[model samples]
Target: MRGLSVTETCFAIPGDIDSPTGGYGYDRRLLTMLPSFGVNVRHLELPGTYPAPSQGDLAATVDTLNSAPPNSTLLIDGLAYGAMPSSVIEKINRRIIALVHHPLALETGLSERRRAELEASERAALALADKVVVTSPATQRILEADYGVAKDRVTVALPGTDPALRATGTGTPLQLLCVGTVTPRKAYDVLIEALLPLKHLDWRVNIAGALDRDRETVAALNAQIAAAKLEDRVSLPGVVVPATLDRFYESTDLFVMPSRFEGYGMALAEAMARGLPIICSTGGAAAETVPDGAALKVPPGDVAALTKALESALTDKRLRVRLADASWEHGRSLPTWNETARRVAAAILDIPT
Candidate 1:
């Protein structure tokens, strides 16, 4: 796959690229790592805005596809496909494949109109693709149920954590880490509310991720924290370097993500790899990723439920031990990036050479 021309269409790469918006962080890593499995990848950056790929942009994309070499395999990441035009997707080369993290329409906190548009775009892309790779069984179910894609067209290739994230050494003041963009979908506010209930516990919550998309939601969460007098117990450290994040994971006692929805919960997997106990909402693919008994699970947006789970993880020594053991065992089963790339390559090649 390293030398094969693997064209990727994605919403954005890193900020260093032509894309105006920064990425979800995984795209850049995948772009660099996929080549190790023999994929000679070319990234095509799409616009940041929703209802993406205007008429002119669609025409340009079609022209590019039409001119590409015969048998060139186009890899369309699901995020970019959801924003693109149906007509544009229809013109995609027959050798194209799709890697679906999740359906954009199911993402939390989108306008109904936008959701409809995204769903339509996804339907078109699914129809055009020769194969589709999903990250979880839950997403595969959605693809079949909602998009009406044939079961044979879809394959599950779970995302893997970076090998660099592992337990380093113990530190004082148990740190509870949550990493993801600050947004309504992430349910940072719900975490804050849960934290308020556990103020008596001697622990700190540090959330590090991009914050531009949810300034208002973040501000409201700050106000809630202040009102609850949890200023000293919680910190929004914003985005941190990989080294810094690994350090946090090493020292952190627990990882919590109370997101209303998640496609694959990559951060949770990273935490598990680091041997950190987890507390996550059983929404979307989270339930599948965070196996039963491995992590405390709560209903999405249920403040009381999250609060209780947080309290248990913070105070119960036996529960923590159980969680740690389960998490470590589960983490060990995760596939490596090379494995993921190989699976993707096999899907692309489809038939014996």
Candidate 2:
């Protein structure tokens, strides 16, 4: 990390770097792993009010990026980068690299006008970057077709999955799990609805994520669960520790992601790492992230479809076994953290002298 040959790269991130979310996890991994590949990373913490930052916050964000070493590369997280004013973007002097976890406009619950505004802002910011790094090919295509980014200007770096022992599920009561922030984008309410008619079955649900990110969504989901009389059947444990999350995966009978969309399904990959059977939506890049052999695919937002997939997985142990076997194989083949870092370092080194 102290070597003179390493590229000086600063990561411009908004919000808690330790927050239990996939995008932050990716950034954190790069900060630690990039140095292993001869790239020295400096963390630039920006205001947490991103995708809707105030004017003052925008000024601070620009100041932070501009403060990086004169020869350093400014690697901005898309959460803040995509929403910055074009005028603000024109001020940064460092070599720029944008890490687009996904387009801001794709988040669920944004109004049409808001979506359009975000799309415009992101497109503009992406246009100015020296390089753009994406998590998946599906997102690369999205940028190519919709964001107007040149195909050659972007780098595809898949998120890594840690190796894990195959799960030994508890059959006494089938455990269904979903790991992600409890935002509208995750479609937790929709998952609740899909689980309603299946109350008579022997099963439990754990939707573990940060509930603080969207209080209204959490409150609405809680009310929905109570009204459906699933208070005892479903649990919202908020954010669990890494060890606890691993235990949840180890004991899970089926992994479910009813997300409306995903830039890349990191949780899906984690579940696969544990060789757990999956039932995920074909939302955003999800359909392409999880192989058909490992999951029962359903269109995002279709409660009926999700319910059908859930029912089949619950009753058919043989089906789960086949899916889990495929999952184990696929999980073993998923990328590692060092590889992810190598690609990010390569993207950083590619910046002009």
Candidate 3:
């Protein structure tokens, strides 16, 4: 079979891709792994915000598409579609696949005008694409119900976990880790509030991510931590390198992602891969990401429920063991990048291009 070639419209492979905007992280690991399956992947970086595509931007995209080998596949990741010209979409020589991380309009707490703009842009993108790829069944349903995307046109491709996150140690203080940008959508404030109720427990939280987007929310979270006297108990260590992140995973006893919404919690998958027990909210795609018994699920924005779950994880050794075992099972079953590449190749084969 001929190898498949794919290009993405944002955060290309082997790049320094970090965002302070609570956006997802795409790393070099994917670039290194995908090629093993005979798939050639290229990432194209685009501007951050949207107001429809400018002529110059559209021209650049057209040039990129024209330069691609005939029969190659192009995948536009989320907002990239909104920022590309309709003429470019209509004239592309290769098959077009769009990956919707989430409906950009539904991003938590955007103003009405901005939300409407995003919705308009997303609708245009969906209409222009030949096929759409989503990570979870929940997202598929959303696309069908909200965006009016036909079920047949949307493919569900689950994201893979990095194997480098395996567990290495068991130690004291029961290190709990939360990873992601500090933002309102992540509900870091709720996590902080929940920790207040568990002050008597011997657990420490290490929140690692850049402070971005939600400045007000981040400020409130810091204030809450200070007011609750959790400065020593909870540390906001900011962004760390991949090796340091691995060290955190090795030392971590549990992972908590109290997000109000997530398209697919990549960090949750990474933590589970490391055999860290999980506690996440049942919002967006989280229910699909976390397997039963592998992670505790709670209603979004519920501080009391989060507190109770954290306390249980800290005090009950049996629960921890159960979670660890379940996490191992869940992690082991996840598709590797080779598998992901195979799936992408299969999808490309089905495309008429």
CA RMSD, predictions in order: 3.9, 2.9, 4.2
In order of TM-score, best first, we have 2, 1, 3
The C-alpha stretches of model 2 lying farther than 4 A from their native spots are 1-7, 351-353
Which lDDT values do the candidates have, in the order given? 0.74, 0.91, 0.73
Query: Could you give candidate 1's per-residue lDDT for residues 164-212 as a string of tens digits?
Result: 4456434346678998888888898899878776777789889888767
What tens digits encode model 3's per-residue C-alpha lDDT throughout 152-195? Answer: 88876667666755674455778888998887888888898888
Deviation from native of the Cα of residue 164 in model 2, angstroms:
0.6
- Ranked by TM-score, the better of candidates 2 and 3 is 2
List model 2 lDDT by residue over 160-225, tens digit each. Answer: 988899999888799999999999999999999998889889999999999999999999999999
Global fold similarity of model 1 (TM-score):
0.88
The TM-scores of all predictions, comma-separated, are: 0.88, 0.97, 0.84
Clashes of each: 5, 0, 1
